[model samples]
Target: MSEPREITYAQAVREALRQAMQRDPQVFLLGEDIGVYGGAFGVTDGLLDEFGSERVRDTPLSEAVIAGTAIGAAVTGMRPVAEIQFMDFITLAMEQLVLQAAKMRYMFGGKARVPMVLRTPAGSGTGAAAQHSESLEAWFVHVPGLKVVMPSTPYDAKGLLLAAIADDNPVIFIEHKLLYKTKGFVPEEYYTLPLATSEIKRKGKDLTLIATSVLVARALEAATQLAQEGIEIEIIDPRTLKPLDTAAMIQSVCKTGKALVVHEAPMTGGFGGEIVAQLCASEAFDFLDAPIRRLAGLDVPIPYNRELEKRAVPQVADIVREARALVRGEY
Candidate 1:
């Protein structure tokens, strides 16, 4: 009923962290250079000054150590928000994240709760090269215990991050490196969005454009352009990956009778394949006008060359072109 408050994606995230810390003394933040450096991308710029080092801690460069410590604190009744710096570096802490944090509750017969949130900058578009620009959400999505969250808009980012921190389970919050500057509306009031709900960003009947992270923005742009050509594209953003909202996905596919899943991850074993399989596995397959389509990143290491890296991931032009064919029943 009223205009939403506009805010940058980074600020929305910062506000979520700040508010969570303020509300719960058990909630603290730990990350490398997050305090003094305000995070590598300045998302935690003023947190250190506000919450002090005890709560807004700056940890060593070891991701395993960071994750292990956070998990321990969480198990001991602390709501710890750990920053991974880069999603590509998650490999360095696979043991703590996958084995310990993810499996602790199940191994202990549901007696333990790893109320920790691992926030990391993920995906390419900033020319950070292979070691810095990786979309690794699919890796954790396969693990049953971990909750994987990837927010595509500022409003959802704030609410979801809050929900992640308040959870009694471990959550991997993947923030796109290229989406920090993107601005959107965020309510000043605090609220925790549901864990795995998918939101229909834009509605249409001809085709469904499903995307995640920055690709959601690209998909929205492509939808707008497709409208000019008399093709309406419905855009869906799965706010959480592990506990994916398959019901909404199936509903959208059933309504539109056509689906196009897009992502920044490489084609081979990318999560897009999982979505396609889920659709075909469901009754929604009967409603398709054509085969479900997938548009994903090229199967190659991210290049340091700006233009090459830009071309590697799904772009607006790619979504636009791909959505057109799906709506035309050409695919």
Candidate 2:
């Protein structure tokens, strides 16, 4: 096969938005600091120049306003892509997201739809402090009618964002801030993949490691290091968290007979707990040779101190150690 096109994570997302915006007249962007500032991470850079301020309109520093406005625009026939500066700030717009966008269709007898994309950056690695660095995808995933997505690689970021924009339901598109500078293969042309699908990034028969966003990269790295130690690790990235690809999960666990769920969220009440429960509840539990393992963030606010912050969340070495333990049936 031919070589895949390489692109940065930020550029991959920009290409998705640019292509979708260029292809569909109804698609537009509205958020804070997007027009003149080029976005917090420059993901929307040059978009205003090409699409103009009319479509790439800037709004106040209010997540509620951005969210509510996008929902209204969507219901009225416009496809609006809203950007929340930080995922932690999403709480400001929770009412609009949960009450308005998520419930509008079900409450309205399925006659109306909230077709919008909420793009926000989450997780810590850039010394962004507590409030600026939070992985809050679990909060939204619990709500029905809202699609939650977290793409780990550059290719998935571009493909999933394109798929999200085309989705009929409201989608929470989360990007890990630390992954913006990372590069990978991205097709130059526009493409769309299903929102609720999971990807098997690496194939193995010894163990299954399911991760999201930044954790996917860390898991893959750990798998490479583990390879030298005579251990095989199968890695799965559930690009969409809400409609989690449980079938892929079951298949992986059935093959490996062991599973590990890792994320950047706090250990208490995080989504990993739910994932483990689901795997155990399914028929796949019978195939397991060892118990499932979860390695997540600590139950505390993210620290501003760089050294403390690094330890707050799961790291590469930690995943390697955890994976080793799980395979050894010691975790």
Q: What tens-digit string does per-residue lDDT give for candidate 1 at 8-54?
A: 99999999999999899999999899998999999999999999999
Write one digit per residue (lDDT tens) for candidate 2, span 155-189: 99998999999999999999999999999988788
Clashing pairs in 1: none
- Model 2 stretches with alpha carbons more than 4 Å out: 1-3
Measured over all alpha carbons after superposition, the RMSD of each candidate to the real structure, in angstroms, is 1.2, 1.2
lDDT at 171 for candidate 2? 97
Give residue 146's lDDT in candidate 1 (0 to 100).
97
Clashes of 2: 0
User: For model 2, what is the error of residue 85's alpha carbon versus the real structure, in angstroms, after optimal superposition?
Assistant: 0.6
Error (Å) of candidate 2 at residue 54 is 0.6
Q: Kindly give the number of clashing pairs for every candidate.
A: 0, 0
